[model samples]
Target: MSDKASLAVLLCNLGTPEEPTPAGVRQFLKPFLSDPRVVEVPRPIWMLILHAFILPFRPKPVAEGYKGIWKEYGGSPLRKITQSQVEKLQQQMSENSVLVDYAFTYGTPGLVEQITHYRDKAERVLILPLYPQYSCSTTAAIYDQIGKYNLGQRDVADVYVIKDYYRQSLYRKALAESVDAFWQKHGRGDHLLMSYHGVPQAYADKGDPYYQQCLDTSTNLAADLALAEGEHTVSFQSRLGKAPWLQPYTDVTVRELAAKGVKTLDVICPSFSVDCLETLEEITEENGEYFTEAGGKTLRLIPCLNDSASHIDMMAAIIAPFVDVQATGQK
Candidate 1:
């Protein structure tokens, strides 16, 4: 599609490094951990741990985890999958004279670079976060970065933000369809697990609303799937620091379920639009091993909605109210 001079659309997702190597991961981690929205500790203290300890020692293991999920295609599944989503959105939403592209808030193809690219073309811009549920650590941080860059640019396009869609009906339907499709293929498991990334408990206590929204998402999905209370469950994963975060840790929960004689499990990560380290490494490779070793017979991972038609539709709906388009999709 040709770049137009009046409108630009940018899709933003948490990024990954170029590859699954230590150097690649280290590069990715630097900006990610440096974000104040993410770390939240005093800069002096966090920097010390980040440089002296975490950066020095953590890269190898994290790299190894990335290696487990690395595709033969070279780049990270996170970036590749997210790029697929962006391309589809661009194709579907081509009618508004908008040039659609995506950028990472961290790592290469960064936000500033994407904005500069778009600024050269479009007079108006929309920043859409891929996260369905907003956390200060995720969505708000993207807003902050964009705000900082737009500080003194008179030539910059007018910008609009698409907020969270945790309660959107189309989103819930798409999620339910994914689970049902997996069940049809893989056979019904003893339970369906909805695992989301964890945030610090303090964030919720301070009114972040991320945790509550996660619960509501789980409840809505379960009802749509006609799941009994004990037949479905929700948990959290990906706690980065020592701070107390959301409860029912995913790994521990999987182990405990196996211990209770529940075998044959299927897990879906609704929090992630595209599978990444947390979903691929933590849930599929790591927790799958953990669950099986803990006595569960089998564990299957239902893939994320990356580039899926339903997912694209839901994302288009989220931004429809902001744009002047009569209908989305190509003419």
Candidate 2:
């Protein structure tokens, strides 16, 4: 590996608890929930609520939930998978002038530290947040931290961010292929459910494009599968707080579909680039219970496109435009 590379690619993802324990979950959640982009309430009030209300009580159950889904070899599934992605991407991008690394939004190998490491070593950095849809809460937080890092640095590497790639042809095709492959193994479900992580409805009203982008991904995927209106549905999941979130909530929709006598339901969370606690436990374990209790036979949770060949190819294609600038000596 070169000590100094012309380009660095940082694959970013929403982080996980270092350990599937109460203390670990709290440590990860504190910074994650405290971010203004995430919670969106006034500082003082939110701080009081966070410390006095949420933190003290939230960690115990969240930790337990994490333990339920912790990867077999140990450690958070998100961390293990993201590290695998870094290795695979590095191997694929094998250009002598490029280095590949990864960082978490809230935990180990943080964004600021990673960005600073590359600033002195590379001419340019590409920050890929790994969220198919763009959200002020997720993608903007990366931009926010990078902007802050640049504030203290005298020399900064040119940064390129992939804001949203849900619309890209490769992305849509990869998702469609993944879904079809799953069906081929288990046979097709009676209905398909595309469940994306939810953002607060207020954010959507205020011009966050997250919700709309999720819709576009679902719409395109449904078209790719060539399914009719009654054959598939779209819903949002993993919402927090009592406040309203994107409509047709996943849990509610799953229960309703089961109660209405739809036996086999296939669920795919497209917003997630890799399987994490939310998809593994919340959707698969928790919501699977919801479907079964409400009379559904089976709830098949389609896996995320984590570090797969097609996914890697899509990422390489997405990063090619930046590499082109490097090849052209266009700083």
Candidate 3:
């Protein structure tokens, strides 16, 4: 293949701001919130509310949260860990493997930019969105971007999208392993909370499938961990606009657990492949406070499987078949 990658694997994740500032958050959030797949609100009305309320006010606090979690060297934890994932995956795949790269759905090295870059360089491109559970607000947004890009190109590279892979045994195993490792280091908590990012209930009512998928992921992980129903709970986090997101909200659920006398709680975000502002600042600091204030002794946030060996193994396992197909000159 003339030392060029005939097959390209693009790891797509929910994005982060280029800088941990309100202006940076504002720049990243505009396009992200504008997407109809994400907000599910009429553009004219949503735009008014978004600009008048969300953009003007939300960014400052959001940026401060980002700054709290931001690395002095790497800026955003999400972006930094995603970069590590791609680099390590490429190494694991070895020198002659497909070109392994990463892009953000909302920030620099955007969908269209990476799509066009790979299209011009490789014959086949595989988009592996890091979202384990598919949501129209998340995974489908990537598909929407790809569809838009292809509309302008007559001869686009053959593209294959892995919409969702939460069902893969490896993914479940990785979650189990991470939890086990965490518990080994820090004593097990009274309860384990599997928290996934929230989407509007309207989206679920419209058959988004995200709510159910989150439950399924939690179920499988619980099975892997051999936990009884009472040992763990599933909740949703990072809700925006508060028009009734997925029920049993994480914050509320955490407080309720604390109030119920469950001390030393452990929380994990299966929906997040990398640690971002949501997982780092919101889940840890913000929710931790709620837990403590509500009477819980400890709230430990188990880290995501970002660039972990098992996570890379899962990525390689998921992409192996596609690479084999590319090698045989088959789509």
| lDDT for each candidate structure | 0.84, 0.89, 0.88
lDDT of each residue in 1-331, candidate 1, tens digit only: 4345456778889888787889988988988998899988899999999999988888889999888778543668887888888889878877666577888899778987888778777766788888889899999988898788888677554777777888899999999999888889878999888999999888888899899889999999989999899997799998877888898889899999999988998899988988888887788888999999999988888989888999999878876666644323333
Best by lDDT: 2
Candidate 2: C-alpha RMSD to true structure equals: 2.2
The C-alpha stretches of model 1 lying farther than 4 A from their native spots are 1-6, 325-331
Which portions of model 2 show Cα errors greater than 4 Å? 1-3, 71-73, 324-331
Q: Report residue 75 deviation for candidate 3 (angstroms).
A: 1.5
Q: Candidate 2, which ten residues in sequence have the lowest lDDT sum?
A: 322-331
Native-to-model Cα distance after best TM-score fit, residue 221 in candidate 2, in Å: 0.2
Per-residue accuracy of model 3 over 116-146 as CA lDDT, tens digit each: 8887677789999999999998889899888
Weakest lDDT window of 10 consecutive positions for candidate 1: 322-331
